[model samples]
Target: MELDRHGLLSLYKTMTTIRHFEERGIPETGQRGMSASVHSSAGQEAVPTGMCANLSDDDYIGSTHRGHGHCIAKGVDPKLMMAELFGRATGPNKGKGGSMHISDMSKGMLGTNGVVGASIPLAVGAALTAKVKKNGKVAVAFFGDGASSQGVLHESMNLASIWKLPVIFLCENNGYAMSTPSEYGVSTTHVSDRAQGYDMPGINVDGMDVFAVYDASAQAVARARAGEGPTLIEAQTYRYYGHTVFDNPLTYRSQEEEDHWRARDPLKQFRDVVIPQGDITAEELDRLDAEAEALMEEAVKFADESPLPAPVELYDDVYVDYPVDMMKRGVNMSV
Candidate 1:
């Protein structure tokens, strides 16, 4: 919880990198004609950086569709992420999977999926694997408030508690699930309350406060690594953009609400704390910001020049082994 100068610098760098990457990466991807519009993690930058700050590269993390921050915090190369967003062969998924499917397993980033809440069970499964192997690793699932409605989330929580899996369910509750306010869809006001049903510990955190998220996640991680069961953490946060870029939009939320959240941005809060408490200089922070901007520019260039996937690769990664039922049904193999 007490961040040394080095840790604070790293935290600032990560949050800034994530914020810049999403801001620039999405537009560039659109310009390049990637079919799917991005689902951004604009105002919710701290949840990933703070949670992953306490984790090692060996620890596993499963991220949702709005996952650019998780990827950056988990040590994914910005160039590769940008390449994936741009749908270039130089991407982490070799241009096969776009933003929603970006992954770097070597860095313990399982994957990001378009389907909401799917990562919850995947992370719990990874936690169980870590437990069985006695690897002293913990798995974290980064999901959204909307994802809490999925049936699988509850199932995953119940199983993690019953088996004492080393997992953390992090719900980034940004007030709304797409256009619907969370209060309208959710039965409970606090998403963390769901953990009580499975008899596991739960904590609610200010998602915009990077240090608070870091401190709270540290406790949950420590308990998990000590063989305690999973913990549910609901982080209250906001997003500045629509669910995706292609949305018909125009009437869901107000500009005032967006402005309110922007004023309380996590990166700004981190800067305020570090400048006073950690002896960080604004000039130094500006240097880091410039570096982030430069790196992202290079990433865009790399993605722009990278090759596209070969046509033959369409059926290559379909399955480790083609299913017998699939063959029996005589389904069309080409995608």
Candidate 2:
């Protein structure tokens, strides 16, 4: 698929944003000894960027633990996201929610959770609400191959297909679900094949190729919007990092495997394809890299200086209404 100038630039910007943020943000948050670890999507950038290109700000997205890519693709602010990762008072969830639980409801980012496959049902429920209200909004669930084994995901798919809900199930098949290979954990060779049981359209796409993923996800998004039904998309991509900061990848996969995937990096592929096609120049891409780096630096500074949440905030944002005296104690009732 030949992307227009705007589309190419948007793809480049989003992929770069995810890369830079993961490269820097993870270490910054980890170094503070916050006991926080990020499952960085270092190499698997194209799938989320391409898939999210088919969505609007009003469309809902539920993300996985390694979700910085999805968040950036869905138009999340790097500053606020960095703040949330840093657990600062100025974060999107007032620092209450960390990396695995960041959410921006106004932007249609329902939330990310640590529990594997939890977001699938959440996305289905959101899609059910949209369908019932006839809102014309689609809900997306971004999960990893590891999540495919979770029972909730299958239940959600059954419910979604039965109701013909406006939801897209995207499985980022990054070879391994933690330390276990997809071949070992999953029964099917292609995750999309499992969609047959639910009677929905199933598609398997080359996730490393942005255009391919874009075309596939665009079709699924269009189908959902037209009230056709849900679509299950399995994007075969690879991540360049260990499951978390603590895991030694050498225990499961070799340096050669990591290096092999890194050699076919998504950003490099996009540059090779788009730059030669007259859509953008190398210098323009470099400028974008510089701008993204600067933006990240500013975000880090903001997070470093921000205050921790107040003691009283522990009981806040949990419910629509709080205790009467707690609200009267200047608890910022304007939520």
Candidate 3:
């Protein structure tokens, strides 16, 4: 699976964009005094970048709390996403779903789940829909090392295997599940190893290396599209920031450990691998980086300028068919 020059640049662009989005958006949360804390996915850009590169707008994906990268990779507009974080009416969910709950059904992003392992079944259900419709589309479930132990993950894997659903169970094992390290939590050395129990192919890839992730995901996606069962992919990645905006990782992990992972930064790794190939130059990558920065600037401006949701419309979108008047009428009634 040789990627063309365009494909290589696309991968670089997506990763850079995600990096910039997180770097810029995290600060906005603070400046705006947002109540909801953002879970930054700064260093784990490669996992979503590589996996979503293999998917189309019609394909589905379920994301975790740290899922802005997933949304960006899956073709959701960053401007809309930023607006959502700002709680603006122009947001994808009309300011209802904040940072952790950002979603765009049109882009096949089911929604980022606040619950640890909840998104696993959402992707599986989407896979079953694709299977029933014979749409040839696949779904990817993006979770973390902590969620790997959740029962929903195991149950979803088993169901997908039995039904031969076109889904990929992607576990972004970033060493720790919030504060709990993988060593103290997971029984297996690698989360993918558990896939054997469900009779699916289990793969462990260097999540920091975009090319490695791309290759593994491409194969898994191909297998799923061909009617094969689900594949469990454990990406050994790391998050540069704490689990959420406020939690300091230094409490549980050492600076030396964080520094070690930071040394092999995914963006730098991409440059190291691609620049020498002679197809993409340093100037080109710099230009892409500048473009990503500019895009985030515009996203922030768009979000900041967008109006807040109107208070009277609070009942709007609560139900698909319910009248707003009916909901307002019942608002003051006791149960």
TM-score of every model? 0.94, 0.95, 0.97
Residue range 1-335, candidate 1, lDDT tens digits: 78888898899899899989988999888887885657888889899999999899999999998998999999999999998887777889987778898899999999998899998899999999999999999999999999999999999999999999999999999988889889988899799999899898889999999999999999999999999889999999998788887664347888788888989999889878778864889888998989999999998888888888876566566788985456435665554
Cα deviation of 166, candidate 1, in Å: 0.3
lDDT of 2 by residue, 67-171 (tens): 988889998898999998888999998988788988999889988888999989999988999999999999999999999999999999999998999999999
Per-residue lDDT over 121-158 for candidate 3, one digit per residue giving the tens place of the 0 to 100 score:
99999999999999999999999999999999999999
Rank all candidate structures by their TM-score, best first, as comma-separated numbers. Answer: 3, 2, 1
Clashing pairs in 3: none
Score each candidate by Cα lDDT: 0.89, 0.90, 0.93
Locate the minimum summed-lDDT window of 10 residues in model 1: 326-335
Off by over 4 Å in 3: 323-326, 330-335
